[model samples]
Target: MGLLDELESEAQRRKSNDEDASVLKAARETAYRTVLEPAMADLLAYLKELAAKLTELQPKIAIRHSLAGYGDVVAYVEHEFDVREVRQPSSKEITVAFHAAVSSSECPSVQIEGGARVRAVSASFQRHRLGAPLAASKDASGEVVAATFKAKGRIPLTAVFSADAASGQLRLSFSNFDDFATAVKTVAPDQVNEELYDKIGRYLMREPTDLMREVLPENYRSQLRARVHHEEVKRRWESQIVSRQQEDIALLKREYGIGARFNRIGDAMGKLRGLVSRK
Candidate 1:
């Protein structure tokens, strides 16, 4: 084609592409507004409630370790949760997440003065000493291995919540679960590391059912309780109806004339045999 014709064709192609792009952008925006935003709001509210609960409780784990060369050491490691709030990274996306052990100074940690081997050996006792006293002496003489459980420190835990704008599907993922386990292993001996890791994991996974009782708004909680009660009552009534129907069927079968005929026949036969023997 001529230069002028080619230029005009390219212009039209560009315009078409721009229109398609605009349509996609608008669709994404609508999805984000109608789907992602509402879902994220609920998630953010839940996270905030969880954060408030954790902050108030300030749940702590007691860790203690001992080595052949190094003496026994005890530490009180506390976990603090921090929510990142909602953030829109792109036009079609939103994210909500929380980080455990966000503050170092605020979180309780274990400070040991020993070499890598000594630290590893001592940390093996972490699970055993969980919830024990945190008092420790600072007079030990050895290399220092500080195992802090904070952001960018030992045992960092980050949970991310992501929602797809178009589908409204929510995904929850932990970023550092393996890292958390690895950090525990690094400071603990092989024999006890697994046990310690399992124990710590179980401890961390625990969440009180009533944690949101105080954090959620009163109206929301009342609504939730009412809904739960309604569901429970409905289930109980359904089960009772099924059981009653079954019992009724059984009783009817037992009292039916068919079964009575067999009993009557046996009784008559016995009476006739007794009369004959007397004669």
Candidate 2:
């Protein structure tokens, strides 16, 4: 209740607040200097080496890839990167996770195969594209939406230095650097089977052949629809995975860049820690 007592209490409160703030700042700086700095430095080096190697392989690795689609039509795809090497810059293992996705659509076309005129579409075409051949349903009422055959894994190029790291590395084989194609196939949407494709010849064609009937074979339409739905689920999950991959990478890099370093800051921290411990 006395003036001196009130002043003493106020001084003690100020000291506590200052100590709390200093502890938090020290913790942040320690985490940045010890955990984040080294991780970032190794990342920079790994990425630099990777970029150089990719650049060297660009001549062969970066070729214009063209796929012959229906009727001699060719579709060009992006220059796919072969994981020539996972950036092993140091003893500290880093997960070099990259995403690969491919989307294919069918073109309405007639092609002669085995001397027979066949109406065909891409085997990997989205299932919904060929909805219930002639069945009436809510799906039939709406414009048919086709989903892409997307396969993705956060592995292959992904690595981790520690015994336990928060990542999807468990799903991927960290050592399988050159197995990109296999990885894609493993994650890709299940394509409609050949038997179902044969049954839906009329449905796949841009212009239905007169010999074929609109009525799909018993169970074939349902089978095709089921495949479409299955693939749709995969697409949704794949996209989310890709988004998260970018988000996590961006967040880490951003945090690393903040207060990267100033020379005296280290010495200043040493003094601050000494004082705090003495108190």
Candidate 3:
């Protein structure tokens, strides 16, 4: 009778232990499905949207296009003109290169000689505005013609009329005029909007290291030890999931007469499900 009583006591203890393990396993499964999976899904969706926005705002120059990408952004523009000798008092000519990125264009050449005194040179650019008027003039011998305009107002201004005529070719030059005009009328509004959007996206997605330092409290360490600590915590949480799964399998095998091999397989499935649902 004494030996039988001891055996019964051991059985009861095993049953109680199995009950506790089962309760913990159920709670963990519930938490994984209810909380962790949704959080991870939301995080990935937001990152994808951010990458798309960053690709839209780059500038266009010549045949090449510029814009930001998921991890970075870029913008560029180019302008070209030529200078040639003509039969007139104006022995020298000037050209201006304009880029929409800068929003301004002006002839860099200074103190130009052998022509009528070029009092001033300047340019302006506007993304979408009505075309402004320009004027042209001819030399006394009618062998040479030149165009010029004054600088006025804020950005989005037109280039002054200026050109060099030679060899039956009239090379016209204007600061911001041609590009701005093309962008406003020839380019589709949606295309321009997309470029601007990309620029804004790039600005927003810039690395946040500087911002993080500025915003962190005094208690925060400069070495980013917090990230390491967070990773350790995550590791521990995953380990707990594995431990819980093993305990569950042990309980099932001991109390429910489930085979050891079958319990082991169930434990693996539980572990996979836990990881999939974890935040």
TM-score of each: 0.33, 0.23, 0.21
Candidate number that wins on lDDT, 1 or 2? 1
lDDT of each: 0.49, 0.38, 0.37
Error of 2 at 164 (Å): 24
Model 1, 240-270: lDDT tens digits are 9999999999999978877799889999999
- The lDDT ranking, best first, is 1, 2, 3
Stretches of model 1 off by over 4 angstroms after superposition: 51-79, 86-153, 160-174, 180-279
Say what the RMSD of model 3 is: 35.8
Position 111, candidate 2: lDDT? 30
Model 3, 1-279: lDDT tens digits are: 699999999999999999998886665444434432332233234434553433354333321121111011112333221222222432122222233333223311122222343211211212222122135454687622343332222223222211111111112223333223221111111222333334323322332222112245556764568788898999999999999999999988787665766889999999999999994
* Model 2: per-residue Cα lDDT over 28-113, one tens digit each: 45544454435445444554465455456543221111222222211222223332233332222334443222222322233323
Top candidate when judged by TM-score against the true structure: 1
Worst lDDT 10-window in candidate 1: 182-191
Better of 1 and 2 by TM-score: 1
Candidate 2: lDDT of 199?
28
